[model samples]
Target: MVFPERFSNLPEYAFPRLRKLLDVHQAGGDPINMSIGEPRHPFPEFIGRAISEALEGFGRYPPNEGGEDLRAAIVAWIARRYGVHLNADQHILALNGTREGLFNAALALGVEEKARQKPAVLMPNPFYQVYAVASLAINAEPIYVPATAETGDLPDYVALPAALLDRVTIAYLCSPANPQGAVATEAYWRDLIALAERHDFRIFADECYSEIYRNTPPVGALQVAHDMGADPDRVVVFHSLSKRSNLPGLRSGFAASGSGNIAAMKQLKNYTGAPLPLPLQAAAALAWRDEAHVEENRAIYRRKYQMADEIFGNVAGYQPLEAGFFLWLPVENDEAAALKLWREAGVRCLPGSYLSRAVAGQAIGQDRLRVALVAEEQELQRGLLRLHGCLYQ
Candidate 1:
């Protein structure tokens, strides 16, 4: 049996490789899992009631794009939050999760045969694995742009050569970026939007982590695109209830883009996408409409961030995160640091290199490790202390 060679060269998903590295070690103390990004906050109290009330709808297959009420709620939320107006019917599509939308958007919008060259999908070096897979799945060349300290932890797509930009079909950007916790500034978004407009490629903004931040909310890609008067189709934003409402189990999110792109995505989804369960959709509608629970969730993450600062602020090579829950700490070697933390401190983390690819003579993430701050206050404090003691002391 022959298999596609494209997938054959892909590295093992980060978690399994982490398991192989630390599973053999005897933990030194009570285990504190700082590896995965699953939130430990309480979801809204009404979610259970909402799900119970909508349970009957589960018997019916959900609409592929999303129900009217759910889509409208998402639209209203976007308008209120990002100041970007979207027509629910024309520009919004509900997703099982942002991952689904992020991956499928590549298939739905990625144009491989435009003039001659194989289309390129540009992504940050240490990026969400889905972006690379999506690009490869569409038979496009995946370009890993470095988003390390040298680049302010955001990929500099604007700086790429004009020739490469011309062949670019889509650029995947994560603000409050995964692992690094770097939020893109308004100026960053403006430059990127202009570049996308000039090059005629779509910007896939993975804003799933937008809600969990410190100080001001991070500027959104769609909002910047609108402000710049770029073609509406040039930017697509994916958001989720996973981080905002602390409802990862709900598997609820939405994609907002130009009418044409949303229509194309909806068409593809009709044949291949799995809609959020009807009951979950009903719960998600309420989740999107309510911001009180979201505020509380953000407050918890803010407190955790403070705790991290208290613990690691003075440590050498520690860069405090501006937003998001992960800490990208510079270490001698990511894998070595991770193994030491697991065995000596009983705290598990992901090695940064696992999340990035080598590019242009540099492994951008080679000397860092990503620590998730998704545990409850007490556990997170203990984990942070353990990490500091293990690594710094």
Candidate 2:
């Protein structure tokens, strides 16, 4: 049997790699895992009831484009959150999760070739692994631009050479970015959008962390594009109830864009995608329709943000997270630091270098750690204090 070679160069997924690096050593004390970004907060109370109420829908095949009720709820959420109104039927496609939409969208809309050559897909270094996989799946060149401190922890796509930019057909961006937790400002979004317009590429904005912030809600890509009156098809924004509503298990999310893009995505989904089960879609609709639970979840994360800052405040080079639930702490050597923390302190964290790839013989996160703040309040505090004493003190 033969397998595809496109992913042969890709590193192992983060969690598995973490295990391989640390599981060989015995934890020095009680284990505290701060590795993965899975939320520890409570999900909405209504989810179970909502799912039970719609149980009968599972008896029949569900719509691949998402049922009308679910899409309408998503549209309403978008309106309330971003002040942008969209037609549910025309502009929304309820997804199994943002990862599904983000990956499959490439297959649906990625150009077969551009500028008379293989098209290119641009993504920030340390980006969601799906972006690179999707890019390779379509036989497009996956350009990994560094999203390091010098660039404000966001990829500066506009700085690339025009000749290279001309080959771009898709650009993947994540705000309140994972692992690093850097939020992009409106100006950043505006500049990126303008660049996309010039280069004739679409922006796949991953705003799954949009609902969990400390202070001001981060500006959104769809909002910026709408404000600038850019072509609606230029930006397809993917959101999920995973981080937003603490419903990752529900696997509910949606992608919103212009009707033409939705049509193309919907067409592809018709053949290859599994629709979010209708019972779960009902629960997801309820999740999106109500904001009280989201507010409560946000409040919990806000407190955690303060806790992280207070604990790591004086540590040299500690960058306070702007949003999202992970702390990207600088260290001497990422893998070594992670191993030492586990072997000596019983604290497990992801190595930042594992989240990124080497470009031009250099990787951005070679000397950092990605610590997830997704534990119970007391447990999170305990882990942070132990990590501080073991790694910094």
Over 314-372, each residue of candidate 2 has an lDDT whose tens digit, in order, gives 89999877899999998999999999999999999999988888988987798889999
Model 2 ranges off by over 4 Å: none
RMSD of 2: 0.8
The 10-residue segment with the lowest total lDDT in model 2: 1-10
In model 2, the clashing pairs are none
Which regions in candidate 1 have their CA more than 4 angstroms from the true location? Answer: none
Kindly report the root-mean-square deviation of model 1 from the true structure over all alpha carbons.
0.9
lDDT of 1 by residue, 122-192 (tens): 99999999999999999999999999888988998989999999999999999989989999899999998
Candidate 1, poorest ten consecutive residues by summed lDDT: 357-366
What lDDT does model 2 reach? 0.93
Q: Can you give the lDDT of residue 175 in candidate 1?
A: 94
Q: In candidate 1, residue 307 scores what lDDT?
A: 90
Clashes of 2: 0
